[model samples]
Target: MPGFLLNLNSVVICSHGGQAKPTVPNPRVRVMGMPVTTLGPPYVVAGCANPPPPVNVGPCVIGNWVLAALRVKVMGLPVLLQDSQAICVPTGTPLTVVLTQMRVKGM
Candidate 1:
């Protein structure tokens, strides 16, 4: 599916509401004036509300993007998009794409 490209400015979060930040944004590609995020690099999560133990083992601390644009590439790696899918480590929860650059779209 085609969707807006994800940039360093894109707002992404884990299922538990933790903010997700790309560990590495591709400097070779820019979208909406920010570096575009690519697959492979893990996203670090912080401030997750999901509690540990009895509540459920969570409070997601890291995320890995497993899916991304099929056609868009930055340095031979697929670029992440608004529709890209990611999973939080340890919790097995998915990341939510809250916002992305509206200027560029990719499959």
Candidate 2:
């Protein structure tokens, strides 16, 4: 299995807001490497930190370098690291990442 070094702050977790419950610092964060399972939910496994017995919850991270797979999505965006085959990224090129998730509230 391949692995990727990821910044935990860059990953997104879809879940309920803390207004319904007390905030927990650095909740257990996990990820399932992509090409996702056909017709089913993604299978989650340990991605970073020394995980403690797997508790599912909202978004949380202490901002550290953790290992995951390039297939995983970070912050609702694709990591776009590498391919299954060896490919070369052109040097000195400008790249732009466009985020499609926009929110307009509390106007």
Candidate 3:
């Protein structure tokens, strides 16, 4: 699916509402004056309210993007898109794409 490309300024969050920040943004490419995000590095999550006890497993701490643009590449790696899928570590949940730059679109 073609969608807006994810950039450094993109707003992403874990399923539990934790903010997710890309560990490394691709400096080789820029979108909307911001560095584009690739599928290589993990996204660190913070401020997750998921309880860490018997009630639930734990809060989402990290997000690993498992899917990205099929044809878009930055430094030979796939560029992340607004519809990209990511899995949150420990919690085994997903990351949500809240906002992404609409200037660039990719598959």
The candidate scoring highest on lDDT is: 3
lDDT of 1: 0.90
Could you tell me the lDDT of residue 30 within candidate 1?
84
| TM-score for each of the candidates | 0.95, 0.16, 0.97
Candidate numbers sorted by lDDT from highest down: 3, 1, 2
Go through the candidates in order and give each one's C-alpha lDDT. 0.90, 0.22, 0.93
Query: For residues 20-97, could you state the per-residue lDDT of candidate 3 as single tens digits?
Result: 999999887898889999998999999999999899988998999999999989899999998999999899999999
Q: What are the per-residue Cα lDDT tens digits for candidate 2 across 18-53?
A: 111112212232323212111111212222222233
Question: How well does candidate 3 match the true structure in TM-score terms?
Answer: 0.97
> Which pairs clash inside model 1?
none
Better of 1 and 3 by lDDT: 3
Best by TM-score: 3
TM-score of 2: 0.16
Q: Write the per-residue lDDT of candidate 1 for residues 59-99, one digit (tens) a residue.
A: 89889988999988989999998889988988999999998
Candidate 2 lDDT for residue 106: 11
Please count the clashing residue pairs in each candidate, in the order shown.
0, 1, 0
